[model samples]
Target: MSYIPPHKRQTKGSPLLNPTPAPLFNMRSDFNKFRTWNIGYTDHTILKWFSVGLDDELRLSSLVSFQPLSPESFETKSGIQPLSLVSTHQGCNEGIKNELIETPWLLIAANVKKDLLLSFQHMKREMEEAVMAQVKPSVVARFGKILFYGSSSIGKDSLKLNSLTETTLRKMKGSFHTDVPPSYMDYVEDRVAENLGQEYVQGKELYYVKLSDKLRTKSIVSCKCTVAKDHNKIQLYKIELNRVRHMVADMSILGKSSDLRLFVNTKKIKMALSDEEINEIKDLIASAILDSEVPSGIRWPLDKRHSSGGRYVVNAIGHTTAKSL
Candidate 1:
């Protein structure tokens, strides 16, 4: 019997949707010849012997003993058919050998375990320290300047002066002169006239005063005054009555109230690994692992030998603690 490719199998259903039956092989003679070679036999050869469809009880017994029964003994088993085993075994062996040749690396880095772990920890710590050194000084300088200045102007042009509204001016006057003496109103009037080139008049109750320029074209300024009841003195000492727009709008209300707080945030700097650096590290670790010999009893499957080595190295490095370096 000749070997049939899965696509060329005589099956009515689709091979993908309904899998074709396992290939049969006349392994009775080959099994006797290679029965003693089980120690060195690969999984591919063992699987072919299994696909011969031996009885469940006999298959289990043979697997346990790691031996193939005689061809005459298989004659008693119903529906036991033998086909070409030599060609299938040769194909399986060629594939297995090619896999072994391609993946000359170990599945696990058992030899360089300590060295790899130490190197990873050292690399992580060095990277963290370098990043902190680069970022800490800039962050500290910016935050310190903000805290020390507390929104003070560094130069004259930095401060802007804006006009105050009549309603806001009235409120300022009321708050400042609420507890001042009647004589304080006279002093305020003199100051207003001297500074603004205006004349101030006292009202009947002295609770508020109206002021106009010398030409009296229109009222230029208004004043409100009151006498203090507790101290019987004036409390209108520093009255500028001007509100300006802030340079930093976010921190505008910082000093307006005693209990108000302003929070300043620094932009976060992201630490990223570039493709070049990632590839460099992977190659470095792969070289280290391949330089060491693989231990016995460790099976280097095709997948592990080819690409999984790099993945394992990355995962191992990531698991280490930078602080513990």
Candidate 2:
């Protein structure tokens, strides 16, 4: 036998160089055929690399080794569901969208990984130079979750449209389309915020747990509140005061204590909040309570109170974390 060169020998099994392509990707096969499908693979080598071409041959050989006589053997060992590979920008975006819908956790994990990788990169540079602000864990965590949520949500509207009936589909197909609302991602967003808040509250006296739906989604509201019959520019801060009476009475005795703070977004106004929006935020904060969730035994109208300096404050009272007076 003539000695075959190593490179030529290796190329023998390669589906690309092989004159007879592997059975899985054979042009004649009806099941795995993609000639008409136009499922674009960036590299033709992708077929050989991922076993898309050789899958059927390998599967058949494995089946024959077992020597099953059943008709099901032919059906099961011969075919595989073809994946839609993409190369173009639009196609890649669609692929990402499809992937996110199928596996939202993957999106979340990817985002988290990306953020962590970025932070570590930043840290590595900082250690060498020693002048940069170290990335905060909370910031990294927030970004990861946001990326995950955003990637996952970009295609939900298309999915909804695809699910519509023919008549409705026809109507929607021609109609002007608005973008998907951001509310679908509120759960993930709330969970991230909840985790960050918990971390922020560690070893700190968490006074006044604000038990309201409006308080959770927003930390600050830079809208005009109708105060005393005038639309006054109000900047409301979300302060979770667990025990308003106890905390108020405690603060009355011993001056104001330290609390975690956040700023309101003056740019986006809460133009119209649904009943669900209010309730969702309320439930999130209530669930964050340490022990009892009941806000009873707190002072009357605890939220609307003026401090000694004539500054407005809203005390969110909850029984989660508290020390009674």
Candidate 3:
């Protein structure tokens, strides 16, 4: 009998025999193209109060207010003891006062100590009320001026890094104009692309983007990606089916072919598949394995058996050696 190579073999009506063409949507390129516009930013001040039970009363141990810190700073500072518990009210109050002495960022009322000795819940409520009552009026008075005048001045002076508006573009053009007018914009775009690419591609993080709703109804299709280090590129895989199915692994001697078994619940699938569909799925799996660039001396056979099952069991065999290519 004549032998044909795996890649050369052609089965009639096999989708794998003629693989589907690549789509227009290149995930990496498309993501980089719109990364800047899709990027989001927010600025806000947070007020936090550390409390500890003293005697039968709850005391506002420490108060701090600041903008959000980086993940590393937050992680490190979160574990630090903000307030130390003392034996007496005088010591506790003195400790808090000493901590707040140089810290002008915290807005604590003069009567915070007087409001102590209340229930934990009540103390938090009263302290929050007092802080807001004192702070809200001042904020309201200055908000209008800040909104109308301060924002414009700040906007003009601050570096607009990722803004894509026409006004921002014009401002950038005026500030960094050279003999080649488009060079600066191109450089900025490339830098933004490089940053995003480094973060998502080079970083050890899996990227999964969901497909459109129009694609399927029950199971939402998604594109999963991982860096193929050997190939020095990203490998994108689509996951369309995610139903909980019984898996049975039939491991054999290393380098020896093992039975590829798939057990599915008929009720879950909800329909009986024609032979053509089964062949297509099998062919697809075979094509994927064939297309994969396996390490030299490794051989993974394209053979599988489908069975209906409620439970599945896996079996392992002895070690086998592979011949070096």
Candidate 4:
């Protein structure tokens, strides 16, 4: 028995990507400028106020908030304190003013100090609200544009890289079929000729336009093949079947060395059968043909369009045979 290696058959057609990732961020300027400003300014202030209360009210430690510095610092920097617990309503009272000064200890012991913390919290919240007011739209707009509409056309560099990658892949895949044995290659070539109703010739391989309903319901040119044994003596066949149906009511069979393949256009076959079951039936029926046990009714209908009598239309092949109940 001669060895038949696994033949790498090259399909002479283009294939598309499984899932195409869409582009994000269309505009360069807007995408870059977005989120440049900090929206956490108010959050920072609130954190500082909490820090202050931890030290002053809770007496947790002597650490003053390094940020949002004390009212005294505000007076020194801006020529005024943000809030005054002391009033100069009395006439030129230096001693009273000195006593009321908002030292760290005074703020800690004040009865209304909780109110001051609450006011500080409210102010921090308001500042945060203001900062986010400016930042939210820019951020929202960036995501909205990306989700609703893809980025503008890709750059030239990216397009060129994709093209190069596709071309290289095709070249690599093309090299695979170049090593297939001539006998195996001939098998595929003959099937193509038989499907197209043309005589099988040497050198030139025949190709058929396969029609599938599910994968787009379109036709694709494919290499046809018949049953052939591998080196392990395992019978193998490659035939294109319609996507919509299970059993093939219509097909074009191509034979090789007494091995015939029933190309079932299962579109008309309403019944279902596993590949193993289908193969078993085909082998059994073909064996019965060799033994002459199959009924005379089992015949290929003549093609009315191509021949005078019409084509061979068998209800079932292999194991599953159709019979009137």
List residue ranges in candidate 3 displaced over 4 A.
Answer: 1-205, 217-219, 229-232, 237-325
Assess every candidate by TM-score. Answer: 0.14, 0.20, 0.18, 0.13
What candidate 4 gets wrong by more than 4 Å, as runs, is: 1-236, 243-275, 288-313, 316-325
Q: What is the lDDT of candidate 2?
A: 0.24
| Candidate 4 accuracy as TM-score | 0.13
lDDT of 4 at 12: 25
In order, what lDDT does every prediction score? 0.23, 0.24, 0.24, 0.24
Ranking by TM-score: 2, 3, 1, 4
What tens-digit string does per-residue lDDT give for candidate 1 at 1-325? Answer: 9897633443233221221121222222243332321012212122111111112212222221111224442321233221111111223344433222222122112222332333233333333544422221111101110011101222322211222122221121000001223364556576855687776443322222122223223212122233334433211111111111100101101111111111111211223534653453333323322111342112223343322223221111101111110
Q: C-alpha displacement of 296 in model 1, angstroms?
A: 9.0
What's the CA RMSD for each of the models? Answer: 46.5, 25.1, 29.0, 37.1
For residues 140-188, could you state the per-residue lDDT of candidate 3 as single tens digits? Answer: 1000000001122235322222221223222221100012224543563
Q: Write the number of the candidate with greater TM-score, choosing between 1 and 4.
A: 1
